[model samples]
Every structure is written in structure tokens, then in C-alpha cells.
Target: MNKTFQYVSYLWDEQKAKSLGDDQVALLIYRSNILGADLRITNYGGGNTSCKTIEKDPLTGKDVEVMWVKGSGGDIGTLTKSGLAALYVDKLRALEGIYRGIAHEDEMVGLFNHCIYDLDSKAPSIDTPLHSFLPFKHIDHLHPDAAIAIAASKDGEKITAELFEGQIAWVPWQRPGFDLGLQLRNALDANPGIRGIMLGGHGLFTWGDTAYECYINSLEVIEKASAFLATNYGKKRPIFGGEKIKSLVGSQRKEQAARIAPLLRGLASSYSRMVGTFNDSDTVLQFINSHDLSKLAPMGTSCPDHFLRTKIAPLVLDIPASQDLSDLGAVKSHIEKLFADYRDGYKKYYETHKRHNSPALRDPNPVVILWPGVGMFSYAKDKQTSRVASEFYINAINVMRGAEAVSEYVSLPLQEAFDIEYWLLEEAKLQRMPKEKALSRKVALITGSAGGIGKAIADKLAEEGACVVLTDIDEDRLANARKDFGKDAAIAVKLDVLDNDTIGQAYKAACLAFGGVDIIVNCAGLAISKPLAETTEADWDLLNDVLVKGQFKVSQAGVSILRTQGLGGDIVNIVSKNALVSGPNNVGYGTAKAAQIHMSRLLAAELGPDKIRVNVVNPDAVIEGSKIWEGKWAEGRAKAYGVTVEELPAFYAKRTLLNEIISTKDIANGVLAFVGGLLGKSTGNILNVDGGVAAAFVR
Candidate 1:
């Protein structure tokens, strides 16, 4: 009947638990999902949960106690049964007999594989020992911002003692490993009936005799810590002192962010190409515009999870927030200077602390960049990683806000941070990752992507690992077009190529969502079939406007973004076989196609110096899955050929040498053939996907 505390609440669904019945692991998963669902409780993949249960031993045909814990690289929020690693509880505890000290902590991680009770279990993580050595049956080790705020504060232990009054225990800073596990065990032994323990500058560890009880315990601890921070909220100016710079008003911040993101993206990708994500949320702006930003940012983050993802600290650009950043060249020059210094500082940091056996120096570029007024920009190998990196820094910002509001925010010391960053085990994990996709770091913008050949082209590029920007004049159609891709994969924008402003706006959206464009696809077009005598002025204008002018505007905008990124790019134009073959009732459409073909060749020649390749794809008789064939274009073409609409596929096929009908998917494969790395060195070439239309062949 009584709620435990304010600032956070419990979320135990009794009916949901009843449905799960007596399955312990299912209950554990239910609990983990609920805890990870709230950012106030934990962030994506920030924590691990485990529960001890009785399982039938596969080899011995006997029941034994086992521990099912979240495995490596798995997110608690989206975890499945396969993501759980089942280990022998008795075998895990037995490792203490041959236990080595802190220096040999990494060996403990290797030993976890030996304790695997299930042959199909996922690989164990470094936190395995921490969960196993604990005395309770169910444990929740979480990086909740509220609890970490107290844990990461300088006076954390004292603050926790005064608030919890021995109901919780505090252990000083230590990396998560075998030694930390032993320390957690010792603290629980000393405190007897204490419900939880706080790991200084790290996170919280709460346990219960059962799965549901463990969930409630974690909720209670986090809620109390949050309420305490709120009560201390009377210490006004909950920033790093106060605002030192004036943040840009309204949309100005994002406009500046959009313009500046590509420049920063290019700079960040110097060592290896990367995708970027930008954030200007109020929390980010507050930190960026604060007076103590310069002082506090350099201290870095305290949580190891934050430290690993963001590195030691971010490169904070100290521009007066109100200063006009519209001139990209000016902004680039200023940032270039700051970037060089940051690179030098990073190299110095590595050299200062690195041991002889440390792994080789990594890319000196910063993962996180703080822009006053413009907010935060984070870069990584791809969109999802870049996006998650930004979120981690935001988590750090919240941690800092709470800690600074109560006590000085303290980060992990430099030596400890370095040890974890370059550890041999961490290096091994990095080396074990799979090879990158052909277009892994590339971003593509495809026009007319609502359906048919345009949609097919977008899917092809995305399949090869490129982030896609789906644009079409029909906004409603664009929504359905983008439904299949995740936020990190594709974004839909209403773009009418006739309007140069809409063209510019779409490029801006791509730059904001995926750093910049690396591939431009001109697939948006229409067809008209009428004799010269029957063709009206409006028909001629419509064909040329949508085909000729549209390709120019879209390609021109794409070339600008590619130039800004300084990364070589590809532009694929989907022309028609009619561009080369002269057929009756195709005068306006054929002329527009011819212009598009020649323009590709001309632009290919001009843009070669910029490392931009332009290629043309000619698709013929692609009636299936094409929006163009759904209306007058198909009817008009059918009438001109003296055949019913249903007979067009066979009629067109009979005209070709191969007598094979083409589908929209075949056209998509043609686009992929051009953009995929197999043609990395070829450009200005036209490939015909028309089943051998000899008249349309290139001479």
C-alpha cells in the first residue's frame, strides 16, 4: 500500500509474473527487461543481471545449481534466451581455491569458459565473477544514473553512509574483475543482513533471495538515491557553475549543427571512415554552455562503461555560442586547429601512461566532440555505434549533473582508465570482430524511393551496409517506403526535385542523420508516350522537369556533400533504353532520357578530379514492381505498341534478343553492381539491363 520513495518508482507486474509461472530464467528475463526499459534505471547494455537456478545437467542426468547471466555484447532490454550464459554455480565458486591476485585478474575471465554448464551458452563477460562470487541467489548490477551519481561523487562513501545508514555498504573504486568480486563478497559478509552495496565511482549492486525480490531491491535503492539528490537540488545553478555562453535560440542550433556535422565527420574519419550522430538536446546544450565545461570536461567520466565508449574526455570547442557559424570554411579552420591540438594531447596521454606491452596506439581522433550552442557530435564505425556513443555521453552528463549538485564529480583516474582501455583482453575483443561490409561507412540518398525501382535501389544500397536517405514528392508514400528500415538505416524526406530548396533540405537531413552522403542515386522519373503531333507543351515540360532537371538538382546537391566530406563517392543514374533507341510515341520521354545520359557523362568527366564517380544504369521493360507502370505511362506505352496492358511484358521481351522480361528487382541488382566495390575503379560506363536490346547497345 505504501510507495518506498520518490524520484523513481517500482514496476513489478504481478499479472505478468503469474503468466511466467515457475520458470526462474523467464522471471529473470522479465525482471531484466523491466529494469533496462527505463533510462533512469539503466542504459542500453550498461548492466548485467543474473539469477541462480536448478537445471538438469546434460552430461550427468542430475539436477544442479546453475547461474544464468547476461552474456557479452548483449543488451538487457532486448535480450533473448540465447543471450544468456549458463555456468555451473559450484564450479564458479571453486575457482577461489586457485585464485590469483589483482595482477592476474584477466585470467579469471578465461576461466569462465571452463565453468560453462550449457554447451550452447553464449560467451561469458568480465562481470561474470562479480555476479558469481556474490552471496545471493539473484543479483542486479546496474549503472543507474541516480545511483551512479552518488557512486561517482568525491564524497560518495560518506554521502551513501549518511543516507542509507548502514542499510547499504560502500566499497572503493576498483575495475570489474576477480578482485572486485572478492571485495563485493567481503563487504556483504561484513554487513550481514544489508540489502545492497555501492561500488564507488562505478555502480550499484543489489540482491534478493528471489528474482522478484531482487527487482524490488534495485528499484528501492535507486529511488532513495534519486530523492536525496532532488532534496539537495536547492543548491541552485546545478551546472558546472553557471552558463558562460549563450545557446543559440530555437532552430538556429540545429541549423548550425547540420552545416558543421559533415566537416567534423570528415575530420573524425581521417584514420578510418566513420558515420556520425549529432545531439543538441537541452541537457547537452546546458553542459556545453556551462561555465565549468572547460574544467569539468577534462576530468572525463567515472564509470568504466562511459570511459570505454567515450575515451578519457571529449574535445570541447570553446566558441562563443552566439558567434555566427554559417561560414563552414571559417568553422572548419577553427576546428582544424583545435583538432590538431586534441590529437597531439591524445598521443601525449597514450605515451605518458602506456607500458611497453600495451597495444599499439589507436586513431588519435576523438569519439566525442562538444560544440557550445551546437551541442554534441559523436562518430564511430557506423550509425548505430555513433548514435549509442552520443547516448553514453548524455548519460555521463546526467551523472555529472547529479554528482556536481551534491559533491564534486570524480572520474576514474588516468592510470586505471588507460589500463582498461588498452588491456590485452580488450584488444583481443576488438581484433576478433568480423570484416567490415563494402559500404559500411557510406551514406546514400535516393530520390523517388517511395516504391518500384526507386525503392528497390534504396534496399540494394542498404543491404550492402550503407545508411539510406529515402526521398519522394509523396510524403504518405515515403512513410510506407521507410517502414522496413531501422532509424539508423533509413530516414524519409519529402523532396520534389523541381524545388531547389527541397533538394537542399533533403541533403541537410542526410548530413544530420548519417554524417554526409557518399552515394547519390537518381532513380526518380516518369514516362510519356505520345507522337510529336499529339504531345502538348505541358507533357514535354513535365518529362524534362522530372527527369532532366531532377537528376541535375539531386546530383548537384550530392556532389556538394561529398566534396565537403572529402570522401570519394558514387552517383548512379537510372536512365532508360529509350535514351539510345528511337521508338514511335516516345519523343518527349526519349529526348529527356538522352539529356540525362549525356549529363552523366559530362558530370563524370568534371567530377573525376573530386574523386566522385558517375555511372548510368539503363533499365528496360521493368513493368513488375514499378510505380511508373501503374498509371498512364503503361497504358500509353501499351496503346502505342498496339497491345493490351497485360501483354506488354511479353511484347517487350519478344523484341529483345534474349526474350526475357525484366523485373524491378533486376534493375536494383544493376544499381548494386555499379555501387558495390566490384566496380571500384570503373566509372562513366553505362550498363544495359534490357535483355539484349541491340539497338540500345553502346557503340
Candidate 2:
């Protein structure tokens, strides 16, 4: 498990990136991406890396253009020439003192660029002023997982002292951007050879004469801390839960793995570059795995940087009860409870420490979790995300478990977490980049997309236009849709929502095919007929899982992709009339539909400020074979309703004031209206394309 530690050698490869006219620019981006890949180092745009070069000022008769920073809204991995924004060091430093009096941060942000009056489309990183303030030519600021993991602990100061042995200075978490930059200036003045500084739970700040030195310092800091934690706690070796009983649980590890891989894929697609799954259920295997599990689970995050990628919690399993439930219901319930507990703990933590200016709480779900005898659950939003979550979990668990042997493990303080969460500087940096421009280069995933509704919506988006990844449960239909649309228009992926893992995989495929995903349409849904009491639990579960739970899982999985892309995105859920208006024989279908509607709304509200938009399309009875109208349903219900096959259209269509069947075109258009931003200031709002069905007044 030993890895080489090198600064100049690891980060200075010319072949890794495209050749640049300015070698400094090329090195800056390459180094940024390398650091970005390590969770212990960065999270979605949290850190900024820059290179300084002297260029003659046109008017000042002196050298300027001291720095080129990572552009706001660009991930380090995908950073491009357009992603590196420039700032004149002279202007930045002089302007710094000018905006000091501005109380509002946002207003102060405007001042950073005020001195240089020009139409600069790209907003400078919030740290522009700080970069201006720094004398170092190469600066790297990261929320390294190991350093912060120790820094966030109860005795962070003490533990950090022991780990680094006075190699670096430490600062309490301060609001990043201007204030922290000023504080860092003070720290730098105090400690001369301090290669790095830990900002409590926030992250780490490091600088050197070049990108090579900065990156090397980042890697060395984490490696040293990891070594300390391992030496202290690695000897514990093992931990255990309830013993598995064989009779009740026939080894379904393969089956479980098969079932979960797609779900994990879906979750992973939402965040990373790739994803992988592993499952094992042999009692012997479980025992073998227990030692590592015990060591890692109790350990806090490998480092605070891991938090941005994997979150602060992992799913733990109680072995005995897992075998009792024979069906997926039990598994779903068990997993749900773990996520719920994590969320609850997060909220309680927030309440305890949010003395004032508490920001909105992040979703409590663990990015990665362990399934005990069943192995592990790597819940990433994408492939690279999967890697990020998996690696961080392993490291965090290893470190924390090791620390427990020497001392009680403690988490980063709540206030420190808050500082990272609502650090206005990071938010401001994200705000600088344009939303449309940020998402312009990425791909998207759209489900329930054959012909009619899904097709039309997809087409509209393609025209707008985006690289669309389309999917549906219908194999033949999906094939035809692809043929007609052409491969250039969209890549058709056959997906079954019933299989959670498949849906996950579909999302991953979409992301891989197209650098990243920018939008997701949970259009895969169906209507089942049955009286309320007569609807069997099986029926209820089937429809509910497909419509409600399916959407939930997909959205949850897609979040990381959207966030990582840096540009916020849009999610459109195609709901039904049953959600808004009750109808006979719509039991299980209606219930699930209702949940989908509310879920979309809640997500819209929660993700709004992040620049993500969520909305729903509730269309009334659409025409047969016309997207929302499944022709098969008409055949089954025709006999039950005592209506001729010919009369079904009239029977359904007459319910609307327009007296016309809602076509797939109408439903799809309504969905596009929201996602395309046609309807302004209308988020979390439902648009009913029921042919004015509500105006009909069902007697």
C-alpha cells in the first residue's frame, strides 16, 4: 500500500495537456486538475490555482498581468483556455483597499473589477483580490481531506502539531475570499517557511515559487497526516456487527450486486468520470472484510477535503435483521433509514452550531456506504465521482479507526463545517461564470424518450441545442427513435426503471459519452388501473417504485454531475392528472404520481439558489400511441368501461374543455417550456397541459 511521494515529478508532465503558447498557463491547468482529482485536496470549484507572469502594462510603463486564475464555473479536470481568467495585479491590489469599506460582499465583488472598466464576461474568482494580495507567483488553495480531517477534529491544533511537527502554520476556519486572504497575509508574515496553512475545517492554503512546489506540498501534507493516523490506529485491525444467520439468508450477494450496480452507476453518473461495483456475501468473506470495515467506519473522513466528495457519513449495516426481510422492500427500507439518520445527524449538527448566519443544510445522504456481508455501496453521481467516494471512504475510515486506538476520534466542529458550506467566497466565485456558458459544452440524460412527448422535448433541446442522451424501457421503440433522430442527434439507451441499477448505469453511460450531464428528464412513468382497496401491495410497490422512487434515485444520482459541471441545470418530471385531480380506478398510479409532483417541487425549492431548476408537466389524457398515451391501456380498459375501441378517444378527450385529446406534442412542449427557461420566475411550479381539463369541471 505504499505510494511514492514526489512534487516536481508528479505534477510537471507536458504530455498530459494540450500545448499552450504560454507554458505557465498549461502548467497551471494541469496541476489544478491533478490536485482536483484528490478529494483530500479539492471539491467542485472550492480551490483556486494560479500562475504569475510579468507582462508590460500598456499605460503604466511597468510590468503587470501578474496572475492567471482558474476561471469561475470551470472544474479543474475540464478546464480550458477560456476557463483561465486574467487579472492585472496592480489593479487588483490597489482596488483591494478601495472596496474594504463596502459592507455587502456581493457589492464588494463588483468593486474587484471596477478599477478596470471593461465588458469582462467572465467574473474573476472571488479570490482575485487575495491573489492580488499574495507576493507568491504560484498559489494553491485546497480543502485537503487529511489536513482538514485533523484540523476539524476536537483537538485539531494539538493533533496537527504532532502530525506536521511545526512544518506548517494553522488558522481557524475563516470566511474565504477577502477576509481570509487578509488573515492569511498576517499568518504568512508571522511564519516565514510555512509551506502550507490549514483553515480549520475549510481546507488548506499553500504556495511556492511554482505549481510543482505547491502541488508537492499538498501531497506531502496529506501523506504525512495519513501516515500518522495509520501508525496510531492501524493496529486495531478489526471490528464486527451481529453474526449472520445462514438459514434465513441464502447468499444473495451476486443478486444484490446485480441489483445495486445500476443504482450505484446512476448515482455515480451524477458526479464522477467512471464507476465500478463489487459485492460479496459469503459468511467467510464477510468475516474477512470486517477488519477493514471496523477500522474505516469508526474513523472520521480521511480528511476534511473528503467531505466535499464523500460527505461526513457512511452507511453501516446490522447483519442479523438484513436476512429477515425476503424482498427488496426490506433492503430499500434499511438503506433509507441509514440515509435518514445521516440527514438527521447533519441537521442536529447544524442546529447546535449555527449560532448565527446558518446556511441551508446540505442533503444528508452518505456519498459512500458499506453493506457489511454484502460488501460496499459506492453511491457516486458519476464514474470519477465513484472513485472519489470510494477512495475517500477507505482513507477516512483507515485514519479515523487508527486514531481511535490512540485517542477518541472527533469530527470537524459544526461552525467549521458551516464556514465551508456557506463560505460566501466560493458561492461568489460560482456566481461569476454565466450559467448557459458553464453548461454549454456538456451532455444530458433524458428518460421515457421514444416518440411523441419525450422525443419532442428532446428535439427542442437539441435545437436549443444540447447533446441529448435518450433512454426508454421499450427496446423496439427506442431503436426506432434513435434511427429517426440519428446518432448525432441523440444516443438511445434502453433502460428499465424497475431495475434501479440499470437506471444508474444509463446515467453513467450518458455522462461518459458526453464529458458530463447538464439536464435530466424523469419521463419514464406509467398509469395502472385498480380500485384503492383492490390494488395489491405488489401492484402498489411496482408503480410506486417506478414512478416515485425511480425519479428520486435518478435525481439524487444526477446532482453531483450537475454540480461538478459548475453550471446549474434543469430537471423536468412528467407527472399525470392523477397527481393534481383524483379519478376512479387510479389507486397506486395516482399515489406515486402525487409523490413525483411534490418531490419535483421540493427539489426545485431546495436546489433553486444553486441555479438548478426543477419543474413538472401534468398532462391530462393524451391520445393513444401518442407518447403519454399507452395504446395497451386502452385495450384493457375498453371492455371494462363497456366502450367500443373506437369510442375510447372521445371518452378520454371529451373530459377536457378543449374537447381534444392531449397530444404528446402538447405535453412535451410544456416540459420544454420550463427546462428551456421559457417560463421565467416559475420554478417548483407545475404546468398542466391537460387540454384545459381543469376548465371542464368534471361533474
Candidate 3:
């Protein structure tokens, strides 16, 4: 903590607010963005804000006071006016009277629904009651890490009071509900001059007559908390020494993570079908490498806000400091037992805290895993959730570190964690998420994904919600592709498919990035047209290396990992129509592709018993954006067809019965259909993506 607000990035504009109608709601959205822009203030959908405004009631035709609060599941960082739910203030206040006898969460949700002022508004946040009960015109509640550090300490209340000099009230941990709302109101009534309230084991709330005042109030409190933490904990360091864990430190650690991720993924799938995203970031590595990791990690999250995402505690994998991670079979057995024990412990925790009306026990698998030698692994239904959990854990580590520096770090009671985890309002967010796409929890590996058909196939897989590992010899192009697809959805690895070492490394990286591969699209190839008599040995070797042997190596690596996970998978080889139909002066290219097609058929037969489907997609004349159709190759192909280079595309399309121009996207669609199990029971089959080329048809 710098004395000043070093991290605040509020870019609020008065004219922009005026442009949006210059009302309390506009100001609310503006301030929310300001507060949400910094992860230190609020992380991914973790905070809420509200404003008291007047809106016309359709039923009574009169202006009535309404509370416009952040809607459920809305992230303030990207929130809009429509993301705020409007509720009748009077009706909401009346709920305090009737909500006393009702303890059921469903009943409370229904009552909150009945208080909605606008039918078209989104569902109000579960914390709406606290904002509604407050007397201020504007209110903001955030779970800033700095505030959580102080609020989650052993003597959190005392530390909070000393830090803010009693300018803020401290409320003990209470599950969010109507009763907690009343308690907040009572605290405000008792401490009328307090500018803010720090909710123990939860978050902070500040309010004022205007949105700017409340926003500034939140910033001031966070700054003071940051200062206190820096003064006390700035020099503290982890107890572990780098030399003591040399084998488990630096670059080798990532290799260890890669080896263990697939094993953990397999174990997790035993509980559910959720995918695990392995993160070996500097933050995670530092935390996991600490000698006190077992002690700190089991101590629960820094705040209860993370419970919904990361659960009460992380599952700690028992990887010995000097263990030989190279022995994968032994490592797998060790991790299996660790996972089983973790599940048992989780069951015990649930048994101790569960209530009569609690929802059925969630999958006992931990959302976050702490493997000492490796790094943190976050598991969820898909990549997005796993990334969110990873972020929360990283922030929690920082907060816990700060708290430990000052004093002993403590978390909320396990009971409170369970309450929030099972809360109907919290559960509603998961329920409201749109149905997962066909390939939502799948991971795909696409070679030569820097551009052309491989790039298109990678994009399509990501669009369908698959975590994609993009591999290409073109490092710059692969980096750009990763940036375009985002870090959460895509990972880039420089892979020369022809090299056995690179193929093996790429497979390991894919497993490390996203559990293991569910689909492998072999789209790496080169076009070399030469007559059988003139084709040099170099051309034959190049074609065979990239087209035939490369596919086999990649498939073998992927299949080994897939078999270890024991999950059914898909393998789609991007062969060519030339594989079936010969063209003059194309011996080298056609021979290699034909060999790959036959290899795919053999692989399909061999891997069928393991539930892995192998198929081929033959795409012809995909000229647009195809690197194969460049320079002398395109001119020569045009000359062969008795047409100019400009007419080559139209010439090929006319030769097909469909008379349609084929594209890389068309080939990508064929790969997607095969990998998506459109032909689940059909293997050793070829799907044509050549606009219905009669000669290439493989009936």
C-alpha cells in the first residue's frame, strides 16, 4: 500500500454520464465501472452496487421509489444499465416484516421476485436486501483483497477498527439473507457517523447520497487498508528456500505439472465430467512452493466470496520434494490415493456442517488442487470457470499472505462457507447459465493452427467452447492466434510435427494447459506437385515427413495420453481428395496423403477398442487463404487446368457437381462434424469437403 491510490484506474467521464441521461442509474453504472476496473477492488462478478431512484409505476401511474441494484451474475467491470435490476423500495422494505418466519431459500427468492418494480429487469442480486435496507441513496459493496486481508485476520474486527480509526463499523460473519440485512441496518443505526462497514469474512460496504461519494468512500477505505497491510507485511517472505526445492522450482516445475495434470483430470472425471485447467503461473508457483503451503492452503479462502468458485479449502496433492516425477506410473498411483483421500475429507467436512435443508452434497472433488512440486490446478465445468477459480485462488493467496504477515490468518467458519455455497441465490447463477455447447468440456489439439484450414478448425472448436491447443512452427502466427482466442480458450505451442521431440512436447503442453486432449485434428501438410520421374528424394521425404509420419507421431502421442485418462476421444485427419483420385505431376503429395488415409483407417481399427474414433476429412481445392495454393504451385495448377491463376478457383468449383467454391472453413466444418461425434459409431470413414467432387467420392 502506497499512501495514495496507486491502483485506481477510474476513467469516469461526466459527459458520458450525461449522455446516458445523467440520472442516478447512469452514475451508478459509471461508479461501478470505476470500482470494478481494478481486480484489487473486485474480481469477476464478485461485487454489487445499487442506487435509489424514482421510476414510474405502470400499475399506479405514479412515480415510486425504486432500488436499482446490480443484477445476479453480472460483472460490474462490463455492467450496463440493463444489468441493474429495479425493485420497488416499499415492497422490499415490507419483506422484512414477512420474511421473519420464512427460512426457506426458495421462499425468500419468490418474495424478492414479488418486490420487482419492473418486470423486464433482470433478477436482483441476492445481496439486494442489504442495499435496500441501508438509508443511503447510493451504496457499493466490494470484496477488495486489501479489505479482505484485514477483515479475515484472527483479530479482524480490532484490526479493521484501528486501520480505519473506527470510521467504519465491523459486522461479524453472517450468511446473506433478510436477517443479515436487518443486522446491517441496526449497525448503521448504532453508528450513524460511520462512513463504511466491513463485513467480517465477507466484504466491505460504503454509501452516500451520491454515487461519487460512495465510490470515493470505498476507495479511501481500501487505500487505508492497503497502507496498514504494507506497513505490517511488506517485508514478509515465504519460508521455503529455492535451493531446497531446486528440482521442483523453475522450468522443471511446469514439466512436473504437465505429467500430473492428466492423472488429476482422470480422477476428477471419476466424480464429474468437468475439465481441469492447469495453471503454473508465477503466483501459483510461489504459493505452492512455500514450505507452509500445506498449512496455509488448508486454512480456507481469504474471504467467503470465493467459496462459490473455489470451495472452502483446496485439495493438497502429496508430491514429495525429492520425488522422481519422471516415473509417471508411480506418480499416477501416488496422485490417485491423494485424490481419494481428498474426497473423503471433503465428505467429512460436508457431514459436519450440512443442515436439514441443505442441497445434496456437491461433487466431493475439490475445485482447486495444490500440488507442491507442480502448481495449482483448477477444475470446473469448462475453461472459463476454471480460469475464474484460478484467479480467485491467486488473490486469496495474496490476501492470506498479507494477513499472516500482520498476524494469524483466519477464514470464516466452515458452516458459513457451506451456507453460501448452498445458498439458492448463489446456486441460481449456475442454473441460469445457458446450456453448454456440444463441445463445451472438451479439449482439442490442432496442429499447424497458425493459419489456413488448421486455424479455421481451431477457431470452430473454440467457438463451440472447447479449450484449444494451437501448435505451429510459425511462432508469431501462433502467438497471434492465441491472443485472438484469449488465454482462457487457447494455448499456443511451437511444434514441428515432423520432429518426434516437438510432437511429444506439444502433447505434454496440451495436457498441462487443459487436462488432456479429447480431439486431435491432424491438419499439418504441404503441397508439392511433381511428376513421378522428376520428383526429387527431398520432395518425397518432405511430403512423407509432414503428411504421413507427422500424423502418426501426433496421433500416437495423443492416443497414449487419451488411453491414460481412459476417456473416449476423437481423431480427425485432414487428408486430401488427391489421396483417392490421382492428378498429373502430383505423385509426391498424393502418395503421402494416400498413405495417411490408409494409416487413419488402420488407427481407427486399432483404437476402436479404446473408444477412440479415428476418421479422415478430404478437402480439395480449398484455395482461399490456403498456403498450399501459393507461388509456383498455384500457377502450375492453373496451367494444368488450362486456365489463368485468377480463374483457378472458379475452374475447380465448376469441375465439382455442386459448382461451389470450397474454402478452409468448409474443411473445418467437416472436421468439427467428425470430432463432434456426428458419426459416433462410424469410424474408418472419410467425409468429403470438396463441393462434391465426383472422382474423389469414396462410396
- Count clashing residue pairs in model 1: 0
Model 3, 454: alpha-carbon shift in Å?
A: 1.4
lDDT of 2 by residue, 360-453 (tens): 5545455565665555556543333455455555545533543454455566554655555555664554355345422233356877878667
Write candidate 3's Cα lDDT for 309-362 as tens digits. 998889887667556756578777777787789889989988998888677788
Residue 616 of model 3 has an lDDT of 94
For model 3, how big is the CA root-mean-square deviation?
2.9
What lDDT does each candidate get? 0.88, 0.62, 0.82
Structure candidate 3, residue pairs in collision? none
Give the top-scoring candidate (lDDT): 1
- lDDT string for model 1 (564-680, tens) is 888788999999999999988999999999999999999999998988999999999888777788888888899999999999999999999999998878888888888888998
Locate the minimum summed-lDDT window of 10 residues in model 2.
239-248
Query: Which residue ranges in model 1 land beyond 4 Å of their true spot?
Result: 1-6, 234-238
Global Cα lDDT for candidate 1: 0.88
Instruction: Pick the TM-score winner.
Output: 1
lDDT of 3 at 223: 78
Off by over 4 Å in 2: 1-11, 14-22, 37-46, 58-61, 94-110, 115-121, 126-130, 149-165, 213-233, 236-254, 257-326, 329-371, 375-408, 419-699
Q: In candidate 1, which residue pairs clash?
A: none
